[model samples]
Target: MCRWLAYMGEPLRASTIVLDAKHSIVAQSLDSPLGAETVNGDGFGFGWYPSDATPTTEPAVFHSIEPAWNNQNLREITRAVESPLFFTHVRAASGPPIQQTNCHPFRYENWMFMHNGAIASWPELRRDLTVAIDPSLYPQVLGTTDSEVLFHLALTLGLRDDPIKAIGQAIRTVETVGHAHNVQFPWQGTVAVSDGATMWAFRYSTSGRTRSLFHSTDVPTLREMYPTVERLATFSDNAKVVVSEPLNDLPGVFVEVPESTAVTLDGDGYRHQPFLAA
Candidate 1:
């Protein structure tokens, strides 16, 4: 129901993927080819870690209710800043009101999270999920979106210690609660989270029909494949991006994440593992 991108490489400006690419996030906000919603103009947001940030420093965030393509300030600010790790999102509100507080890439301390999907029958499951959130983290929830709620739920479940395990537990909890409410297929969509260091992206749904998600092909391979593409040469081989959809149409440039899989990206590289395994 929305679109997002997570970049965990090279200290490049956010505009590189948010604006400059062929089918950029901004363009997808206007006319997405792979999204369930064609125009994700409800709002947009981005969170990035400074190149020299310390463990105590929180990542900077910019969220606005303006459409990505029409937000002049978003362009000005993102173009002026550069970070090695960043998360950008263009929202298509499923049920929540359109407001800045409801924007994606929600933050807590050094962590940032964004999502592009919905909690099926959220109205019925909201109370159970909300009550499950650790009381310490409950006071931090500032929006009504299911995405933000899910983020805090993961944190409360131990996101800071083990993101993959915490998230798996969170999803299982959602499924359990949903089943209790007679709601089938409780969760759906792609989610991304970062702690200003490692980045993680998950693609899953209760029915195994999650939204599209992909990671860029290795830069070195792309360079060898398209020697004349000047842009490919600029990226470091370790550069990685996990996006809701391909930023460009180049064949073999992106690989679709398998259903119920979780991708992890760090200084070394990117790798994926089964997300729903018990």
Candidate 2:
């Protein structure tokens, strides 16, 4: 398993959430309270839309095989760079080698994706699924982890045009292949994907009991509840975050994403809908 966080709002220094929260992503990497493993030291990665004039194109990425907590460059970069949309992931290496390429927050064009779960019995079904990927896109598979393969499969199935439907189809495809090989619980985890603006988070599993996932409540409402908490005023009204676990112990600050649901966040607000197999 792994731990990850995604942010979408006004541009702010990455450290404000990635390193400054009470239990920030960096802290969670070393001492995660909700993950299956406390120490996700296998590797870590960060992807963010640059602050340049043309920021909506492709995001800049920084990945390392080193533990996130111990990476000095990550510390320096977080304090230096800022973005309205960003992704950070700490890996625990479910079934892949610990290398830069295997580190997450994978990129394709303008979209960035990270997952905090595993595909059950991946080795058994890898051959069947890999063979199904479109030939032109097949060459992009650069890592051995099931996570990257899953991303490419979603792209092949139409992630760019209709992400929600494409992901549903991809999961259905995985379930169908896994069952034929007698593997129960074909999928498990929390997944987040974002273009430069809108973001989507999904919680699902073949067995129906997925890992923990949460999203922050509206910032304005939180300010009304805790008017004296100065930290609450730092974020803009549109600020929103989705993570594998609550970043702080502040009650009402985070809401658990329901089982088998997809959460979408954009300029309007948050929306939740049932995530069914396609």
Candidate 3:
């Protein structure tokens, strides 16, 4: 229902991905060709590790009820700040109240999570899903959106220790609850999560048709392919981006994540694994 992008690799200004690209995240906020909603203007949020010295382990978050395209603060911060990992999301509220808290890229400690999907029949499934969350995490459920609930559900299932399995279990729970309520096609869209270092992205749905997800190919290869494109030099070899859609139309620049798969991107590169009900 929305559009989002996650970056992991060498530290670079957030604008490089969020605002500077040919089809940047800011641009997508107004014109998302891949999202279920064409214009994701409900609100926007960003979460990133601070570059300055600090003892804090939590990532900094900025959320606003204003449309991202019109937010001058976002433009200023994106150009000034840099991070090894960051998440930017433009919201298209499915049914949640439009508030800063409802904006995405939700955080817990060093972890940042965002989703571009919805839980079908959410009103009917909300009570069951909330009850399913571990009581320890129940208090952290500050928002009413199914997306935020799903995040806490993943945490309840042990996202901090094993993100892959945690997310798998969370989805399985959603499917179970949806089935019990007779809600067909209970899941949709791509999700991205990060712990300020490693990133995990998933593309899956109950009906087998998930939303768009793409990852950039190696920067070095892209440079060789388009030698005259000087912007490629701005990124380090380790740089990688997982986005709802390609930021640019560069051929071979983005590879679509297959349906029912989890993609892990780290310093070693990207790896894909099967994602099924667990």
Candidate 4:
């Protein structure tokens, strides 16, 4: 398993959440009480869309096989770069070897994606799933992890047209392939995707028990709830964040996403809906 954090609305230095928050994503890389593994030191990644992004513009990504807390560059980059939309992940390798290419927040064109779970018996199902990817998009699958392949699969089905539906389709595809191999719980994880303007996060699995995920309460609401908290001043009313776990212990600051739900974040506040129907 892994831990991930994503933000949309109000540009601010990513370090405010990734490095400086109470239980920052980088800090979680060292001691994550919520992650399946206590430590997620296998690797880390950062992906962000610039403030001045056009529809055709793609986000920039930085990947390293270094532990998030120990990487000097990770510290510097997060401190310097402020993005309206971005994702950061710290990995806890389930089976794949630790390498830069295998890092999360894999990118293709204008979209950025990352996942915090695994495909059961990926080695057995990889072949079937890989071949299902669109030939035009197949060449972009650059990592061995099931995540990158999953992203491409979504793109193949219809992510560009309808992200929420495409992701459900991709997960169903994985389950179908896994059922063929007799993998009981074919897929599992929390996934986040963004195409510069909107961010989508999904919490689902074949078995119904998916990874933990939470989204922050709107900043204005938080400010009213904790008026004395100075940190609350840094954010705008529209700021919304989705994370694998709460960034802090503050009550009402974060809400758990219901199981099998998809959350969409844009100019609209977080909208939650059932993703894969039973």
Candidate 5:
């Protein structure tokens, strides 16, 4: 499994959350209490849309096979860049080998995606799923991991037009194919995605028991809840974050995303809906 986070709202240096938070993403790379694996040091990646980028502009990415905590380049770049929307991921390889291409937060055009779960018996289903991808989108499937394949599958299913439905359809296809192969509980994990503006997060699995995921309470609410916590002062009222784990110990600062749900974050704040429904 892996630990990842998505942020949207006021522009802030990526390191503010990836490196400087009390229990930042980089810290989770070495010690994650909620991730399936305690240490997600297999590799890491960062993707963000520059402050100047339009809603459809492509995001820039920085990926490395190095552990997030040990990568000076990540620190340097994160500290130097600021964005209103960005994704950071720390990988704990389930099966795929650690490499740049295999890292999470895979990109396509203006969208970026990352996952913290796996396809049960991926090797058995890869061919059937891969062959289903639209030929036009298949070329962008650069890595062998099920995560990347899932992204391309979503694209083939119309991610650009309707992200939430496309992702649900992608998962549905995976489960349908898995059932044919007699693999039960074929999907497990949380996923986060964005298209330079709005951000979406999903928590689901073939079984009801999915991975842990949470979204930050609105900044004003958090500030009132933790008035003395100086860090609360750094965020704006509209700021929202979705993470695989709570970044800090503040009791009400983070709200757990319900199982089998999708969360959308934008100027309208966070909205939740049932995901992968019939």
Candidate 6:
């Protein structure tokens, strides 16, 4: 259960959506038509925040247990990198062991995160979410993915003092430790996070069936509906994109993202709400 994308505003080029979009993100790591595993190839990764970053600069990452379409250094380092904000992931090792420190955006200092779904059983809730993290972030949790222990349980329940109320108390502490181990539908998912200048995305599930998320439909409403593509005249009417799907099957070019909501983008644009986390 993995697939990801998050890009925010202008400064582009990570091969314009992880290798030229059209089901891209290395073609959903070799074919993931709306994933839940149709060959996510076990591993891949990316993280960016550079376009002259300085909010405590720590974005450049690139994990790889390889096979994001048989890597050639993930296509020459994502076309030699450029960014306004970014994250790209394609992993399908749901029980965590594809190596490269369990890939995905997962960082901490200036924040970045990624996930597609699953906390459901996670080996019976990974020792109650790794002893509820935050003993100074449990020695920096070097990977045993329930998506990097739900991003250090949303940075020990306060993601820098309120990432949407600390991911709604880190997904209500993963459904209160998966219902005291009885495990009834303990979370499933879609999440994205960023802090080198605001970006957040989420979709939820305790069993309302969530997965698939999308965003992008506001370059003045797709330039008032297409008006001669030309890559929508090279974007930048405050360009934005969020995805677990839809890097173009263009019909209003991506919108979904509405099950328990929470999409936000900054520099004054895009804001969604009602994501009560678990």
Residues 1-278, model 3: lDDT tens digits: 99999988888999988998999999999999887988999999999987552434689999999999999999999999988888999999999899998999899877899999999999999999999889988888788899999999999999989999999889889999999999987887689998876799999999988889999999989988999998999999999999999999989999999999999998899999999833
> For each candidate, what TM-score against the reference?
0.98, 0.97, 0.97, 0.99, 0.98, 0.34
Best candidate according to lDDT: 4
Worst 10 residues of 1 by lDDT: 232-241
lDDT of each: 0.90, 0.90, 0.91, 0.94, 0.91, 0.85
Q: Write the per-residue lDDT of candidate 5 for residues 1-278, one digit (tens) a residue.
A: 99999999889888889899889999999999887899999999999899999867999999999999999999999999988989999999999898899998999999999999999999999999999999988988888899999999999999999999999999999999999999998999899988888888999998999989999999988777778888877887898889988888878888999889999888999899998754
Whichever of 2 and 6 has more lDDT, that candidate is 2
Clashes of 2: 0
Candidate 2 residue lDDT tens string, 122-142: 999899888878888888888
lDDT of 5 at 189: 83
Candidate scoring better on lDDT of 1 and 6:
1
lDDT tens digits, residue span 41-104, model 4 = 9999999989888988989999999899999999999999999999999999999899999998
Clashing pairs in 2: none
- lDDT per residue for candidate 1 within 14-119, as digits (tens), equals 8877889999999999999999999999999988999898776799999999999999998897898888988899999999999999998999999999998998
Clashes of each: 0, 0, 0, 0, 0, 0
Over 4 Å off, model 4: none
Better of 1 and 4 by TM-score: 4
Q: Compute the lDDT of residue 234 as modeled in candidate 6.
A: 72
Tens digits of per-residue lDDT for model 6, 1-278: 88888888878888877998777888888888778788888888888988999978889889889779998897788898878888898888877788998988888888989888888888978988888887888888898888788889788888887898888788889998899998998988989888888898989888878988988878978878888877777778888889888987888788898899888899788899898744
